[model samples]
Target: MTQSIFDKFQYYANLREDVARLDTNPFNVVVEQVLSETEAIVNGRRTILAGTNNYLGLTFDPRCIAAGRKALEEEGTGTTGSRMANGTYAGHLALERELADFFGLPSSIVFSTGYIANLGILSTIPGPSDVVLLDADSHASIYDGCRLGSAEVIRFRHNDPGDLDKRLKRLGTKAESALIVVEGIYSMIGDQAPLQEIVEVKRRHGAYLLVDEAHSLGVLGEHGRGLVEQAGVQEDVDFIVGTFSKSLGAIGGFCVSKWKELENVRYAMRPYIFTASSSPSIIASTRVALHILREQGAELRKRLWDNAHRLYLGLRELDFKLGPESSPVVAITLGESKEQALEIWHDLLDKGVYVNLVMPPASPGAGCLLRCSLSSAHSAVQIDAIIDAFRSLRNNILES
Candidate 1:
């Protein structure tokens, strides 16, 4: 055989073998049909959707769908170019203005996706002389952003504001040049950052602070502005990055900042300069969803929380491991062994419940997670059904 460049695929093949020869590939759960925001068809079975991040459940809202249809009929399809090219349409600008107004920030820039927003900002802002102090459990997009930038990256203990403070102190003179980045609500374990303490620490170090509210937006604060507002530290945060995919029920991302200079990021960031802009339908749907997210968000948030509490308490009562006090994302930790975790995931699927099965590289800790993200559209009966399904699999999970 000729020396092959495809030799690297062997590692993936062996890793597949590690998961008990892949009789049930959790990664291959194909959605045959989407019934609603909280239900889908998989494997010819109508499965309860407990894994999606549709917190506000606006995906199938009549108004949002109407707006999307209007845009599709009127604008055809994509913008077909980058923001720097022929892509900055009027709707894009309008959405940016609306987002800045909602957050009460001075400036905002929309990106092709939530991931791109992080990549563009991180790669462009910090250079060789700068530093990024991040949480150990920061999202992959955040980590990839650091890799793209010229900054010196440092991670402290997860959820430890004290450790972050110590790391900043060790930076000494470089502390002033450091950018402290954290998420409002960590997606992996559904835990929150001690933002108040972290903000105080950054203020003491004379460093900048950026908060990614991807999971917290439309799920926290009185009006759902996110955890930065919930903690009453909006003034202390220099920048915020969030997604339209989660709560807004559309696909796009944005970065709003108190500093108006963020507008200049477009000129320097390659991701924004090179990628195609979001379509008219996406932008149109997102704008209407944003409005609904503002007006009806309180009621939706109430429903979401109620469902989350029910599922969390139900699982806990069943003597299963759970994430630290739930909000919307309820992560049930499985065993340290990958085989056991896979078994639990497959069992739940067989019971007509669909949840996110997270393992190494994606999960926060060494253990795997059966992460359930509740939605506002999940009815009380649906919640009961999900709980019952999990209860039915208790024997398998506990025994495994």
Candidate 2:
């Protein structure tokens, strides 16, 4: 029998079969309505939203909504073209300038997404001879960026500065040509990188460092500049990549750097050049969000961290195994089997709470995890409800 192109999808079919057997599909939950940044209607019930990446709870900010609405009325919907053509608008240029100013970087390049920011910069900066040392537990976009680049790729131990130093030393004179990539806060585990140590290592080897603050911006630092500023190593980082989706409450990505060569990336980077520019509404809303991130970010951060600590302590009291600490992302170890994790996840949803269900390969350490992200908008009542809900479901989850 001749094989069809769709034959390769057997793996997906098998996974679906397992899901059907469990009578619980974590990936198939539907959101019927979004009541606020922290509440939603799901499965015909009002559900507390903790699965989303709405860190600052700016999704429902009146200023952002007003900006977007104004942009829609004045600037129309989309640009209808790429930045290289008719897509480049005054608003885009203005937003880029605001971002550059916010980071105190000499140059900034805006992309269609945080993912594309990595892809564009990674593929364009290093040529065929250069090398990239990436953390083994990096995000998918970071890995994809390395694959797209022409450089030789090497994986190092996650958050281990000594291992990175050794890898660079092994490269001899080529160490200076290497790009050491790390994230401000790893997405899956909700843990942070050892930035100060990594910075020292990079300085010792005379190598450049790129920090992805995708999950850290507006969630860290004094005024929400991310881990770079939090660690007092902002001056040491070469390229800083971040997404507006997480904290800025919009859809876009940007790379900021002191090196003036960054602006030239738009010419050679395929992802930046080929894709249509962000919509005017997005640009407008993002601009407002960025302002909020700067002006009133500290208050929001305090509230978010307070909520995080409350939940972290609450879960610990229940004897649940948790991740590193009280981070914006709190992941509970749900055991090692996919079935066990899925069953618990379905139970949580049935209890009127929603969270992310992580499994092996995609999740670090190949463990099943129930991940929740804390938002500034989460109420004290909601936090208590989440904790109580988890406590009540303990027996059911363990099947005890």
Candidate 3:
């Protein structure tokens, strides 16, 4: 019998069935209402939101809402066209310029979403003659971008600059032109990259580097420019890619660089050219959020880190196996038992705490992960509630 193309997903279909049998689905969590940045209504219960990556908690900022409302009234609801066509609204151009200025870069290109920003730049920048060296634990979009491009793709050990150096050395002469890709803060475990060391290795090998600051943008650096600024390697790095969704609390992505050539890449990028640009309201709100971040980001960053440290220490006190360090993204390592992971995840939800339940392939190691992303807007009480929820699951986690 001829095999159906859908046969490939049979295993996932079985997994879904098993989850349904448990009477809970962590994957399709629906928020009935967002009461605040840190609280939401889920499954008809008031739950503390610990998964949404609203790092700076600007999602409901009055200024951002006002900006969006004004744009919605003046510019209509949608752009309805790609930027290369008719979607380059005045707000879009202004946002791009502001982003470029924020990064102190010569050029910038905005994308409809963070995923496509990676796709557009990664797929277009590396030619057939070049090589793409990336971290083994890179986000799916990063891997997909490399796959879409014509360049040969290679993986180095995660967060190991020494491994990257050795790999680049093996390339010999080609190392000079190879494109190295890594993230400022890894999304899964929330550990930061050793960017200063990575920069040294890149310089020694004469290679270019791209740091995806998706999670780290508002969480690091005195100026909140991300790991690049924190590491003080701005001059050494070639490209900086980031998303506005997390810190800026809007839906968009951007790539900024000192190189003037990125302007030319914009025209050649199919994802950027073909996809409809962000709506006027999103752009307007994003611009206002960016402005807010610039003006009042330090306080927000302090609050975010304080909350992260609090939760991290609280979980640690309970003897929970967590990610390596204190970060806004705190992941509890659960042994290889999807059932136990699901049970604990369901329990957390029952206790009015909602986090991300990560299964294998998506998770880094040979285990499941209960990932919690904290935000600046999360108050002390909310952070403690998140901790208490996990503390209540001690027996389940200990068993695993």
Candidate 4:
């Protein structure tokens, strides 16, 4: 008798039981559960969304909606082929040009997704000979890119410039050819990378820096360029990668650079070359979204930050442990236990508030988190309601 390949996935299947016990299913959001106009009728109750990553609240925006509808009517739903084949549309070229102009860069390359954008650029450029130094807590896409590249993947402590310097010192002369990767704002903890210090270290080591601004784009910097510009280090970075998913409220990713040769990568990058390009509708909506983001981002940012600060203060007053204390994404830390976190999550859900319940491996320090994402669309009244819910839940837990 021989074991089958199917046996390997049994571990993952079994892990669902553990997740079930915690009432925390990272991959199990119900259909229309977090939508603006839909109901998550669990036992006949509706819930307000606090977990969704729709940061700018543009998913339901009339402008984006109208543009998408117009494009779909004019260009159909999909391109039906890879960009290397018949997939390239006029919309694609226009979007790329628009993105390049937005960044004030000479060239830009667009990918089917922000994940694929990172995957395409990082994997295609670095070879086995080149070393890829990444933050310990980089997104799975960044890690996957390095794995695909066959580059020596070296990780430093998250956002620790000194640890990065030490790692570069270990690499010695090889550091010059190394590609250092860091996120502008980490998705989980929502803390920003120390760009100035890291850039100074990279300059000393002569390393090329790639900043993934997936969560920072349309959220940071003047005109929402990203944290690189926010930190006043745009000229120091070699590549800037971002996604249109979050703040831009569209699907697709892009890499922008002043380097003329970046355009040549389109020929060799598998993720970009093999994958089908974005649809006309996505491209058009993103272009409009980018325009709006550039002109109106500061006002949105102000609203979002005010919401974040209020929520942060509210949670703190309730004595809930928070990660990073100040960030757009506020995560209520659940310490080292899962049971308590699950109880709080279930209680909050029952109270009509939906939030992300993150557990180990996905969370830093093997922790559990009730992650809340804020948006400009969230009203002060809604914020107060969220706070009141937490307060009530805290009291109930203490009494229990």
Candidate 5:
């Protein structure tokens, strides 16, 4: 008997059954269906959304829509080619320039997606002789990028600068050729990296630093430049990477640096060279979104924080184990039992509220999480409704 390639997928095929027993299934998003906004028909009931990461709420912005429409009309649908080929249009160049200006960096390179941005930059910048030190809680993209580089990949304790320093010291002279990567805010735990301490450690070790501002760009810093600016270590960071999918409310990614040599990587990077360039509409809308993010991010950030505080305080008061205690992203810890988490998740959905159910590897300590991502556009009433759903679930669980 021969093993089949389909056998590998058998585990996932039974994931629903496993998830049902635990009561926590992170991959399913089938509750509510809607075009936009929080209100959605979920399981045939109108539900309010809390799972989405539309942080800035620019996805439905009229200006973004208009810009995208204009580009679609002028440039057709797709670029249909790689950037190094015939895909580099005037709009692409303009967007890159705009992004460079937005970050106050001399050079910027845009990628088709945020994942590609990390992959391109990390894989191209480092080689076999180099080392990539990353936060254990870093995103999958960062890990994938390091793997693509064929470099010595090392992980430190999540958000632990001391651990990072110990690892760097262990490397000894090789630390000089290392690249330390950290996220502005870890996605799952909703906790921030101790960037100042990490930067200090990197500086002492004489290693380059790459800060992926995927979640923090347009949600942190003075003009939403990111955590590098938030930590006041803009000059210390060698490369700053960000995504448009979060606060920018678009779909793309970019890497910005003062180094002119970064431009050369455009040729060498397979991720950058082989991937189809971003569409004209995406570039146009992203450029406009970037402008809006830079200008109005402060005000929007205030509202997002306000909503986050309300939800966090509400959940904490309701006796839910919360992560970090402070951050725009709030996770309601539902203990280690996946079953309890899934029950609560289903109950929340049934009560007309939707939130992300995280479990296992995605959640820290093999814990389960009801992740709530806040946006400035969410009204206080909407947040209150979400809290009410959690409260209902808690009451039901206690009674049962």
Candidate 6:
């Protein structure tokens, strides 16, 4: 008997059937209308968007809109070619320069999305002779990138610098030239990596370091440069990969480096070579959004942190299991019970709030996660309303 290729999806198909029987689907949520930065019409009802990773909430910013509109009108829709071809618009080069300037780095490469940035760099930089050491709980993009490369890949315990040191020691001479990858702030649990400690481990091992600041950009540091600037280890970090989708409220990713040799990697990266470049509108809006993040980021960070703390503290008072620290991403851990998690997630949405529902394989552990990412644009009343919704759940089903 031969196995069908469709046999692989049986488990997921069964899981989908189970969710469908519940009369609600967490994965198929549709926004009927985007009411504001914090509110949207979903399931034919007004819903508070607590799950969106819009850290700085510049999606509705007039300045960004105007810039995008101007670019759309003048440059038309898209570049319609790869960066090495007709896609390399004036805006693309200008944005790359601006990004390098923002990070105080010498060179930068822009990709269409954050996932591609990781894929292009991770797959291209480390060769067959090199080794890639990453956190065990890294995002799927990181894992896929390593698989795409010829380098030997190893996983260290998540955020465990000691484990990283041990692995590097085991590699002997190869450790010196290895690449160590970690995120500034992990997406799942909203916990930040101990960059100062990780940097020390990298230095001790003589390895190159790459920090993905996708979730931390515009959320950390005095100037919102992410954990690198906050830990004062910018000079030690070899590469800083980040996305404009979060804080900048645009769809693009970039990798900025102090080493001039990164400029040479552009030619070797297949992901960069084959993929179409970002549209002029995206680059223009991203540039304007980056400017906003630089100039007015302090106030925005304060508000964002305030909302994060407010949500964290409120959930803690209700005795719900949460991530270790209070950050923009607040995850409520529901132990290994998909049914209960699904119930709670559906309830929250029905109560006029929408959050991310993460399950096993995707979540960090055996548990499921009801992750809520707060936005700077969310008002105090909106925060309280979200809390109130959770409180109602605890009272109605959780506590009982």
* Winning candidate number (TM-score): 3
What TM-score do all the candidates reach, one by one?
0.97, 0.97, 0.99, 0.94, 0.94, 0.98
Model 2 stretches astray by more than 4 angstroms: 21-24, 396-400
> Model 6 clash tally?
0
Rank all candidate structures by their TM-score, best first, as comma-separated numbers: 3, 6, 2, 1, 5, 4
User: Model 3 over residues 1-400: C-alpha lDDT tens digits?
Assistant: 9999999999899889879966568988889999998898998999999999999999999999999999999999999999999999988999989999999999999999999999999999999999999999999989998888899999999999999999999999999999999999999999999999999999999999999999999889999999999999999989999998999999889999989999999999998998999999999999999999899999999999999999999999999888889999999999999988999999999999999999999999999999999999999999998988888899899888
For candidate 2, the 10 contiguous residues with the lowest summed lDDT are 391-400
What lDDT does each candidate get? Answer: 0.90, 0.89, 0.94, 0.84, 0.85, 0.93
- Evaluated at residue 289, the lDDT of candidate 6 is 93
lDDT of 2 by residue, 1-400 (tens): 9989999999778778778965447778778898999999887888999888899999989999999999999999999888898988898899889999998998988888999999999888978989999998899998898899899999999999999999999999999989999999899878999999999999999988999999999999997999999999988999999998989888999999989988777789998889999999999999999999889999999999999999999988888878777898998887677767777787787788999988877888867888999999999899999888799888755552
Q: What does candidate 2 score on TM?
A: 0.97
Tens digit of per-residue lDDT, candidate 4, span 1-400? 8999889889767767656864436457564444462124543467777776667778777888899999999999999889899999988888889888988998898889999999998898878889999999999999999888878989999999999999999998999999999999888878899999999999999999999999888778877888998999988988999998988888999999978889888889988888778988998899888878877888988887898899899988888778665777888777666667667778887787777887788887777778888887788888888888889888544433
Clashing pairs in 3: none
Candidate 1 ranges with C-alpha deviation above 4 Å: 1-3, 18-24
Which tens-of-lDDT digit does each residue in 1-400 have in candidate 1?
A: 7878978799767667866565557877788899999898877788999988999999999999999899989987988998898999999999999999999999999998999999999988988999999999999999999999899999989979899989999989999989999998899888898999998898899999999999999999999999999999999999999999999988889999999898877789998898999999999999999999889999999999998898889888998878778779998887777777877787777778999999887998787888999899999898899889888888866665
Sorting all predicted structures by lDDT, with the top scorer first, yields 3, 6, 1, 2, 5, 4
Model 5 Cα lDDT, one tens digit per residue, 119-217: 998888989888999999889899899888889999999888999999999999999989999998878767887889998998899999999999888
* lDDT digits (tens) for residues 1-400 of candidate 6: 8999999999899889779965558988888899999999998899999999999999999999999999999999999999989999999999999889988999999999999999999999999999999999898989998998899999999999999999999999999999999998999999989889999999998999999999999999999999999999999999999998899998989999999999999989998889999999999999999999999999999999999999999999999889999999999888687878888899999999999999989999998899999999999999999999999898533432
In model 1, how large is the Cα lDDT of residue 237? 96
Candidate 2 local distance difference test against the native: 0.89
